[model samples]
Target: MISTAIHCGACGARMEPGANYCSNCATGRDDPNTRALFVVDGTTGLFNDAFTGALVDHETSRAMRYKRPISVLVAMLDHSEFIANDHGPAQSADLLRELAEVLAGAVRDIDTVGYLGDRFCMVLPETDQAGAMVAADKVMHAVAAHQYAAGHGQWERITLSLGLATVNPDRMGRQDLIQSATLALMDGRSDGSNKVHLVSQMS
Candidate 1:
């Protein structure tokens, strides 16, 4: 029996696990359409408050609520830089699919993948920042190993940058989660290639 409670994102009211409706706003407990926000810069997407909310909703509905803190990892693939001098989206379908496969292999069956524009998001349920880093390292290694199909009948090896941050109900909302990840990703891109940035962790 869980005793902790979270606030209704739509309305500032306390909500407990198994809550199907917001007592203050009368909003449906789990709104699937209220999705997580992603700031995609090329192939990178930052998970924010919207994403956290959705996870909370889904987990509560299914009765598999996450008791431990969790984090979000955002990775983007730059189109122009992906094929160096080719001004287009990354078109290495085989390589991208392979990378995704490799990453999926590393995660638990409960975790899920989402398409946020050109970027992809991996929802790490019940995972903390450190655990996410391990998964990110696996993904980075797998992606770095790929020989992507560059434009104009050429092959190229690409790189990736990642941002990681944990979800905190008190200190953040859905949008804040996205913002933290985005800021971390931007900082990483500025720092150098093939780096993972850990922005925040539950205290």
Candidate 2:
């Protein structure tokens, strides 16, 4: 008899003989849903947090070495918690996934998009503050115009609260850049949702 035992290609976990899937990692040879081991979010198919951080660090180092400008944008879905409570978690996840696609399509080829916790972040390479603002505006309009699944055979409009921070590699770390964008996002949220806030010049 052909043995069903195998190792998970994604996670390297052993699978029992006759088992259809790897018990440890849930990967199967024939499973169509199996994704790459890391670097991808299971839900949205965007880069995961760890991989995102690594990319940010690498980009920051390159920017510092070359003295180029870079910008990061942190965007949060407005009323996302309420959407989850009202429409259910599954629908909320669906909305997030769709939004991820929209974000991916809205950015330039050199830009990177990833999910960072409850928010989504974009890294704009070789972009200064003005260029980042233009990109942010494009994303804002795209998100606001897209229709999201609202459950029960209805669609709803979605808005994002976005924060932008630009760096010229003037002694700023990746974490500091992220934190600056996050602080701007918080300020936007405080003012009300569906708005973009730029990091203060003094920051």
Clashing residue pairs found in predicted model 2: none
Query: Once superposed on the true structure, which residue ranges of model 2 sit more than 4 Å away at CA?
Result: 1-35, 150-155, 169-175
Instruction: Write candidate 1's Cα lDDT for 10-97 as tens digits.
Output: 7656666787654333345577235223321223222223443465445433322334555667777644254534534445544455
Question: How far off is residue 190 in model 2, in Å?
Answer: 1.3
lDDT of 2 by residue, 27-120 (tens): 5557626744566787887887776766667667777778788889999988877778777878778888999999999999668898886889
Per-candidate TM-score against the hidden true structure:
0.57, 0.77
Best by TM-score: 2
